[model samples]
Target chain A: MRTLLTGNYAVAEAVKLSRAKVIAAYPITPQTTIVEKLAEMVEKGELDAEFIRVESEHSALAAVYGAAIAGRRAFTATSSHGLLYMYEMVWWVANARVPLVMAMVTRTIGPPWNIHTDHTDLLTMRDSGWIISMAENVQEAFDLTIQGFRISEEVDLPFTVGLDAFQLSHTAEVVEVPDQQEVDEWLPERRQSYKVLPGNAVTIGNIGPNEYTAKLRYAMAKAIEDSRKVIEKADNSFGEKFGRKYGGLVEEYRLEGAEYVVVMAGAWCGDAKDAIDRLRDEGLPIGMMKIRYFRPFPKEEIKRLEGKEVLVVDRAFSMGYMGIFGMEVSSVIGDVTNVIAGIGGVDVGVEDFEAMFRKFASRKLQRLEWWPREVFS
Target chain B: MLTEVMILSFGGQGGVTAARILALAAVNEGMFAQAIPQFGAERRGSLVRSYLRLSDQPIRRHSSIKKADVLAIFAEKILKIVEVREFLRDGGITVLNAKHGIAEKSYCVDAAGIALSLNLVAAGWPIVNTAMAGAMAKPLEISIESVINAINSTFSGELARINARAAEIAYREVKKCQAGSST
Candidate 1:
């Protein structure tokens, strides 16, 4: 069904189609509207689920985590401080391998108390071992929320899908929502073949000493890496069945014969695509690399851009390290003159893209530090 | 050239609903229009920013609103909390929801008084926020009746009648900007 809805509303409806049995969320910007819509759906009987209302974002994730442990498909969402409040649970759920799905509308953490859109919140949880990805628009936000069901259940890990707060979450766009029959064919019921049994139950979490803890952590790392193959296979299989493909962990738009590329996530792609389209008209060899599956690192895909000058845009910062996206993309690209990007997400505008490109055109990345620069650095 | 404006208000003030009404008014006047809420955390005390990007051309960037031609501040106190200034383009209008007109050039209306006089209860009419929309329309070349139609679309049945009355009272309360007044 084609409808004009915000990314948040689209996600809420997608959860309905995915048949999530438990929904818990506390009101936070960008994320609140989604929960509100979900709450409404529960009230109206459009979406059959337990709309758990918790007083705090902490309890919200806790409810979903508990639900997932009970072997029910569960959901929760939050942004910024609300997400910060939900922070400790990320490590627990990932360790628990709960398989619940979370949608985090990213926002920059505030000292200035900003309500603008940015990726700092979501990126902060990148290493928390959740299967994380971002959405470029409402359609993907919907598609990914459903896709997460397959990825998480198969991998037996939780997933965090990032949409820019206010940027994608609130912006209304034309989205083609897949019908339930199509979605059902594309993504079937959860097949948790891991559970021992009710009659023969096994303890999932434990108070481990260093060795056991390290093994469990290494298993999570391996599981995240293993998900790379599982995700690619699932994406391909989903495309084959649905006849519409958004293949690869990273989606490339018009990059085949292009040189300069801008990496983006969430609704800001609307403007980045615009800037790319116009730059194309002017005959600039520029394109875009949009990372949808942010977790599993997608190193093989990043390796494909070896010699190309890719400009990575980060809506969130990494503080002591490089920009989160730039750092991750750097891990993939060995030694390429790629732009280390950090700019507009929620608080920034489309007009900001014009300036970022102008920087890319100049000798911006030419003098980038080579402290430990290797051939594949 | 159609003029566009944004009104930031509180939740109970009928902010989004009022903004929708004004956007519909602009559409009724044959202007290409868009009305969107500036997305953020949903809370009543926290800011509620709504955008009306009216122009001859269709708007494509449905992102954060950095600059607005006019800004309507519903709560007199929220002005201190949120970054309310520096967004307007030089001579843009700002309507305050205070009891008295601000020293700076602005439209001032006490909507609470008017809502009460009309004997409307239930939603306690965040009267000033509603009034600011009507005031904004006149300067931007939008007709008052069009805004009235917008309010009607958002609400109906028994509740709709009171809201229509609230909107009408709000229209009367708005004081227009002088032709050459420096904002």
Candidate 2:
């Protein structure tokens, strides 16, 4: 059924439909309503699950990790500062190979105390050995989340579905909610190969030698690589059942026969699509390739942009480094004109993008620069 | 076709609810729609903006509306807001909830006075979002019935009827006037 839902509510619905056995979450802006709605669902008997009310995001993830280790499908959500606070446990869950899913409602980190959308929080955990995927809208938030559980359980790694803070989190749009029976048939009960329950006791988290540490790290790295197949398989299987395919690790939009491509992710990609359509109508060759899964890092997709004018817009910066997304893409694609825009909830729209594309199309852009500075200011 | 509407009002004025209802009305008509509240400190008596977009196809632009095809003001004082004035597209339509005279390409309804007369107050301010929504329907090319149906879905029983009445009165009472009349 088609219903108007915010991005946060869509995630809660996905969690319910996924039939997550345990949910431990601490409230934070943008992500608060997601877990809150889940709690309401559980309390009202709409969803059958244990809603663990944790005082802090650290405890939230820790509780979820405990649940997952005990052979249960666990879920949690946090944003910005809360995500930073959960940093230690974030790495722990991945390294421990606890198959859990978390919703990272990407918000700008503090010092200035901003709660609006940005990629810094999500990008900060990009190297944490977790399966990271971003959603472009409310429907994708729902779809990717259900897929996140499948992907995580397949590889025995945690998954984080990154959603832009207020842009999609609070905004309402039409979303086609899949039927519960259909989703249940698509995603079966999570299979537990190993559990820390009674009678199946095994030595876990013991001190290991340096060589053992190297072996564990190697296996985790190889698991992430091999999980690429599982991710694709889940996406294809989802499309077969749900009629929506998000193109595995990366989604390409109007990239063929285009001279320039704008690379981005999250809800901003929607704006880029509109700008691309407007530019195309005016005889400009431009397209966009949205990196859906940032952790697996779509090397093949980035390589396809070889010998093209690449404009990468990063909503958050890495301080001493250039825009993190631009740096990563440039490292792979060789050269990219980075547009570091919307750092602290600043708005970037179609007009702003039109100007950027015009500069690139006319060869007026000589080097990388922050947007709105080059155009607006 | 896509129509963008920007609603400006004070925090306690139900500006966000107005935007949501308008979007729902559009969606009920089988069109794609989106409603968003401006992200910032939301406090009573403070300036607030809510955006609405209705399209024949899927509405994908998730950014704030920089330019609006239609502008609605619940607080008459918001007319002095240069940013709000600048957001209107060239030759755009505007609906205002004010007692003062209106200008060309604009419609004005005494929505606050109507809300007060109807004894409709939300958070100590006369509720005008519904009335303003009714006034917006004409310029937006949406029916009064559509607005009323959306209002009914948003509220219930007596409150719904009161809002529906507020909207109906505003729809009929809005006056068409010349251009550049200060409220």
Task: Give me candidate 1's TM-score against the actual structure.
Answer: 0.73
Grade the docking of candidate 1.
acceptable
| lDDT (10s digit) by residue, model 2, range A234-324 | 9999999989998998998988799899899889889889999999998888999998999888888899899998989888788887888
Clash counts for all predictions: 7, 3
lDDT for model 2 comes to 0.88
State the displacement of the C-alpha of residue A154, model 2, in Å, after optimal TM-score superposition.
Answer: 1.2
Model 2 DockQ class: medium
lDDT of each residue in B28-92, candidate 1, tens digit only: 66665656675654566566778776766544455556667777777767666776666666667
How many Å off is the CA of B143 in candidate 2?
Answer: 3.3
Which portions of model 1 miss their true places by more than 4 Å?
A53-59, A178-182, A194-201, A207-222, A233-244, A335-346, A364-377, B1-15, B18-35, B39-49, B52-62, B66-156, B160-183
In candidate 1 the C-alpha lDDT for residue A258 amounts to: 83
Clashing pairs in 1: A29-B40, A29-B41, A117-A346, A334-A376, A334-A377, A335-A376, A335-A377
For model 1 chain A, the run of ten residues with the poorest summed lDDT: A367-376
Candidate 2 error regions (>4 Å): A198-203, A374-377, B80-83, B101-103, B179-182
